[model samples]
Each structure stands twice: as C-alpha cells, then as structure tokens.
Target: MLYNLFNKVSSMNKFAALTKHFAAAVFWGCMMAVPGWAQSPGGTEKELIRLQNEWATARIKGDVAFLENLYAKEFRITAMNGSVVERDADIAVFASREMKPELITDEDMKVSLYGEVAVVTGRENLKGTYKGIPGEFALRFTNVFVRRDGHWQLVTHHSTEMRKK
Candidate 1:
C-alpha cells in the first residue's frame, strides 16, 4: 500500500511540474505575440528616426504615394499657424503642388517610446514656397507615431514657427 501511495504522489509531482512549464510557455508565447514587445529600444529608435528621414525625403520629392502609406488614416497635423489639417487635405496640398518644399531637414530630434507609441520632438528648417510666396522658416515640431499591425505610422504632427532672436 505504501509503495502504491508513493507512486501516486510521484505522478502528481510530475504532472504539476509539466503544468508549470506549460503555463510559462503560454505566458511567453503571448508576450511574443504582442506587437513591439520583442523590439529592443535601440532598434525601435533607429527605425523611427529612419522613418522621420523618409518623411522629409518624401516631402521634398513630393512622393504622394509614400506619404499616403506613411500617415495613418486618422492622421492630422497642426501647422505652424495653428491650423489643423487632416491627412487627406494635407496630402492634397502635396498632390496639387500647392506647397512646394525645397528643403526639409530635421535637427536635434529626440524620440520617446511608450510601448506601442512614440513621440519625436525636434527642430525643422524648411525652405519652401506656399501659394507662390517663397519662405524660409525654423520650426519646432512634435510628431506622434503609433505601431499597428507590426508597423509604425505617423498619427499626429504639430509644429510652431520659431521666432528669430
């Protein structure tokens, strides 16, 4: 009888050990499935910065297709003049050649990551023309990006024209 009891207890212990390992495996599997959970901070930051550079290049080259793919459907921008423009409207300006951007450069860009969201703050120097009026401006800008479906998309952009001191 004692031998049988010992065997039963040993089986139970083996079952418990297997259960513990299974639970751990399931937990880690879920974590891996979460978007951006496995990305290192350094890698993510570099990717975001690259995206920002791509955005500038797209603007300069007037690549409407790239702009359309980079910005989310709900994307919005608050211009230096405090006017808010939706994604379609903003794209329209580029599509229609209403806003000609000669140069768009980002400087002092700092990126902050929050799980699936990132915020980039920086200074932008722009040499461009709007409505046939040539202009040069220095601006401080904030760009918000969100990770969705394992990719990042720009969601919001706000910029203020810097005053010359």
Candidate 2:
C-alpha cells in the first residue's frame, strides 16, 4: 500500500513539470511575436523621420531627382502665402534656382503614426533666398506621410509663416 501511494505522487509531480514546461514554451513563443508586431510601427516611425531628414538634405543640395523620389503622387502643398502647388509643379518650385545654396531644417517636430498614414508637424526654418525674394522664413509646417507598397511617402505639406508683430 505504501509503495502504491509513492508511485502515484511521483507520477503526479512529473505531470505537473511537463505542464509547466509547455506553458513556458507557449509564453516565449508569444513574446517573440510581440516584437514583430511592435517593430512594424516603430520601424515605420523611424523610417518616416529618416525620409524627412533625407529630403531636407536634398533640398539643401538642390538635388531635384533625389527630391522627386521623396514626394508622393498627387502631392499637395500650401505655401506660407497660401498658394497651392501640385506634384510636379511643387518639384519645379524647389528645383528652380530660386533658392540659393541653403539649408532647410526641421525642429520641434511632433510625429504621429496611424497605420498607413503619418503626420509630421513642426517648425521649418529656411536659410536661403529664391530669385532675390527671401525664400527662407520661420514657418509652421505640417507634412503628411502615407505608406504605400511597404514604404512611407510624403503626400501633403502646408506652411504658415510665424510673423512677429
């Protein structure tokens, strides 16, 4: 009778251990999946910022071709003066010799990611001129990004001057 009781208890212990091991395996499998999900959003955010930085550099370099790839189809832009520009026209504006060899930098940017869409809002400080006209200004700008075919592209931009009285 004592031997029978000992055997039952030992078997129960082994069963419990096996159950614990299976649970642990499942937990880790789930943990690994979380990263792939989280990475998509985080990676998109970082990529959005990187793309903006590259476009900014292209602007500074006056590289129209590089800048062309950065823009999206049907891209819409509103200038600080409230003028609307379409895709190719906007590219023309930038590629035109209006801007001197200058730099465009983004600051105080707040970026939001919504699935396939991202919005970047911030201050754009320009240090350049366009054909004797002051091309640079302290402006508030918002750039919209959309993810297409596994890539984020800039789709819309609006800038408003922050004038001091």
Residue 29 local lDDT, model 2 = 89
- Candidate 1 regions with alpha-carbon error over 4 angstroms: 1-38
Global CA lDDT computed for model 2? 0.79
Which residue pairs in model 1 clash with each other?
none
User: What range of 10 consecutive residues in model 1 has the weakest lDDT sum?
Assistant: 31-40
Model 1, 1-165: lDDT tens digits are 966865777777979977999999999998788655435788888899999999998988889999999999999999999899999999999888889999999999999999889999999999999889999999999999999988899999999999999
lDDT of 2 by residue, 99-157 (tens): 66476888887788775688988887888877776655788989998877766778999
* Candidate 1 total steric clashes: 0
Give the lDDT of residue 125 in candidate 1: 97
